[model samples]
Target: MSKILVTGGLGFIGSHTVVELQKEGFEVVIIDNLSNSSINVLDGITAITGKKPIFEKLDLREKSAVQEFFKTHNDVKGVIHFAASKAVGESVENPLLYYENNINTLVYVLQELNKLKEANFIFSSSCTVYGQADELPITENAPVKPAESPYGNTKQIGEEIIKDTCKVSAQLNAIALRYFNPVGSHESALIGELPIGVPQNLVPFITQTAIGLREQLSVFGDDYPTEDGTCIRDYIHVVDLAKAHVVALQRLLAHKNETNFEVFNLGTGTGSSVLEVIKSFERVSGETLNYKIAPRRAGDVIAAYAHTEKANKVLGWKSDLTLDDAMASAWKWEKHIREQ
Candidate 1:
């Protein structure tokens, strides 16, 4: 089994990916600073996979520590980089933090990968790069627009950095997965999105409100030009997104990449409004959510979903879970975590 390094492996999506990788017989190592995630997630991963991956509490932003990690684990066959500050609102307020955490750390990691004879790299990217696309279902061929937030800008810059790095580093092959909103939890109800403070993402916030952690959920807007007059996003289950990472890795490892640098959009290809999400949560959890229609949030697109045919036919992966399924699993995990 080839050893794979998953940065931010203890995070919501990262933890799920670790379980999937372990189940696939891949030796896994995790690097997380526990900034946005907790160490206890390893237990959830172990419970599911029956194997605990090697974990190191290291921040990728520290260039020396990142290099040291590569030195300590010289046998790493591939790297999946996902340890970045990901909140759009927070990024708007703290732009420097987003750049340093998202961009500088990426450079440090790629620099270390350049030292290796050969490497396969998978970058955790977001669909925010589209920035309110002109078309209904955004495709990989969609022109990259000006990012609406600092966090989105970081993803755009990160992809550019990888493309440029891959151009120079002939031995490196990388893929950037521009994923849509990722929700849900592992079916075991052990690991899920554990936001430190108030939840930034909608699904977690919805769960928190239902669980009484929050007074009420705020629907960002109900005036947008959509079916529900709210912002629409393609919410794919986190488990499905994790599987896509594995598929992208296999493509790079098998030398199937047409170019050293490539990208794929991961989503369910169906847009769901914020109100619809709340409705889905209510249906699955059997709890009427206390939500209010709030003002439109900054940096939020009216509608953003994916044209996942590329991911479907090219990467051989498509989202299998719907909004209801994701919300149901998230509700289960929320109840489980609260009772713990």
Candidate 2:
């Protein structure tokens, strides 16, 4: 089995991707600083996958540490870069933190990978790179507008960095998966989104409020131009998103990429408003959530979903879980953790 390096492997999407990769007979080495993630997540991943990935509690910001990691794990055949500060609201207030953590780490990793004889890279890009898309369903070719937040800008810059690096480094093959909102947890009710502080994402906030960890879920904005007057996003199940990572990795490993660097959008080709998400949670969890419409947040796009035709056809993968399914799993995980 080819060894794969999963930066931030203990994080929400990263842990789930590690599970999928391990199940597919790939050896995973995880490097996480444990800033936004918990060490307990390692146990959850081991429980679910029946194998514990090799883990190193190292921060990627230190260029020397990153170079040392590549030296030690030179056998690693591929890299899935997911370690970064991801909150949009936080990034708006602290732009330098986003740049330092997101941009610097990416450059260091790429520099080391460039030294390798062959490198397969999967960048954990976000749909925020599209900013406020002019079209309803964003495609891979959609022009990246001015980023609304520093977090979004980092993703845009990260993709550009990979493209430019791959252009010069013939040994490096890369793909940027610009995925939308990922919700839900594994069916085992283990290894879910464990935000260190107050939850940043919508689904976790909804679950926390219902479980009494929070007083009320503040719906970011209710004046957006939408059916419910709230911001809209495509909420794909995290499991589906994780599986897509494996598919993309296999594409590169098999030398199936038509070009050295490719881009794909991972999403369920549908959009849901904030109110609609709350309704889905209520329907699935049988709990009435306490929420109020708040002012529109800065760095928020009115709406964004995906066309997903390219991902479906090129990667041969599509999201299989529905909104209700994701909400139910997330609710179940929330309850499970509280009970413990």
Off by over 4 Å in 2: none
Model 1 alpha-carbon drift over 4 Å, by segment? none
Q: What is the lDDT of residue 287 in candidate 1?
A: 99
Candidate 1 is scored at a TM of: 0.99
lDDT of 1: 0.93
Cα displacement (Å) at residue 145, model 1: 0.8
* RMSD to truth, every model: 0.8, 0.9
Pick the lDDT winner. Answer: 2
Over the stretch 197-290, how does candidate 1's per-residue lDDT look in tens digits? 9888898899999989999988877899898799999999999999999999989989999999999999999999888888899898899999
Cα lDDT of candidate 2 equals 0.94
